[model samples]
Target: MNILRDVSKLVCKTDRRALASLLKYAETGLKPQYVCKGHMSLASQTDQNEDLDKLYRMVEVEVRGNDPAVLKSYSWFTTTAAMELGITVGECWTPRKANHERLTLLKSVHIYKKHRVQYEIRTYFRFMQFLRLTGSTANTFLEYIQRNLPEGVAMKVTKVEITAIPSHIKTHSEPQQLELPATVEERNL
Candidate 1:
């Protein structure tokens, strides 16, 4: 099993104590997270680098397919933008049933308005990125009907599925958020 899958499964097992163990295991460090969205959006890196210190990918991906190079490049750029914006784009590859079997990501990008810190808005998640290491990977992008896209921002989703299926494009806007109620986590069982 991939280290992240194992880690996520382990973290999901117990309650209060498990979270502490997960923190030690993940070592996301105690440094304060960069405040955005009226809350801590992302934390500064544990190890300092003179340049490009705040954001480093915690996952490594491997892809095999026949597609336009420009499209692939565009996807990468968008994903990076999403990361900067604090979108909870799962660092997962295709065959999604397995990736999201227990977890469903309700990810979005929210701008702090006055602040230019484009923040990723994860509606909810079970784990952060698995781990950055050696592995063969696929795409596990999701298609959503963007319920509430604020403005001046565009949502770019993965254009294809791992099984070579042509997934439809989806965009979220204000109207959709009106439908779904807020997350009720305590009663998940």
Candidate 2:
């Protein structure tokens, strides 16, 4: 029994280390064996770099996949686009089921204007890119759609879920209302 316990502990330790190494790769795109600089074959280093590149894309997809806000944006945009084309849309996963899933993706996007096709949009984060394309904060996602969408298209969002998504796109609009109203004492000053 003591021997069994020792062996079990060893197995558990090895498993933990393995998990740690994978997580380290996921976070920093580093491979465990290649961490220390030493004599390694050029082929091996190339293989490790390729593996790291795949891991980084997977990590990015995983992060964006599990984000509810990102999923919501995806759903909103896909649903809106589908509605415009008279295509039916349904939830890919329930809120409960999504907790265990690695990715939440829209299965279909049927566009009937300027292009007519029914197919899968490659990534779940496509709408996140669309929001960025519109030069809109996530807070103003609906507003951006409202302004940029074709003449008859529209989208609506609830009062909540207005948290910002970081964007670097520049728009031509001028700044508005940065100055604060003067207080009585401040006015005297």
Candidate 3:
């Protein structure tokens, strides 16, 4: 997902004014602080200018939820998985019948017509890696998600199904085996 590059863009490219202020402070050896000027804080100023409240809402943080870190980590996992799958990361995704929040741990990947089961399996394992990286237990993550689900919400299965193609010849077609000649010159034909 190139986390470093994306984060760098957010920090360096997007926040140019903040960068300039910091640079000015560094050059002058004076703490350059933006006057409140009715803006709560410099950070808030930048956020307000960019409509961060709306952007943060897109992140879908549940105010009632205790650990905001879970939501943040879930967002990271979704982005990483989407990048690995070569799909554009959206504000949300539908893993199955469940919503984005329900599928945060990605207990199962939904199968579709013409979809590659192998790729889905790889993505699932890689998401497990992300879960571990985010200080979550890989084995218990699904159980935890299940426990946290709201009342009356049924958990949907995410297993990918694969079917094997038969190698047998068709019964209606007569099997014609090719015969090779013993001589090299004859084999060429």
For each candidate in turn, the TM-score is 0.17, 0.19, 0.19
Candidate 1 or 2, higher TM-score?
2
In order, what lDDT does every prediction score?
Answer: 0.36, 0.38, 0.37
How do these models rank on lDDT, best leading?
2, 3, 1
- A best-first ranking of the candidates according to their TM-score comes to 3, 2, 1
What tens-digit string does per-residue lDDT give for candidate 2 at 27-89? 675434532233232245446545221101100011124345555665566557645744333
lDDT of 2 at 93: 38
How well does candidate 2 match the true structure in TM-score terms?
0.19
Task: Enumerate clash totals for all models, in the order shown.
Answer: 18, 0, 0
Kindly list the per-residue Cα lDDT of model 3 for residues 78-179, writing each as its tens digit.
456535644333344323222223222333467444433231111111121121111122223445444554433333423222234466643646668887
What is the C-alpha local distance difference test score of candidate 2?
0.38
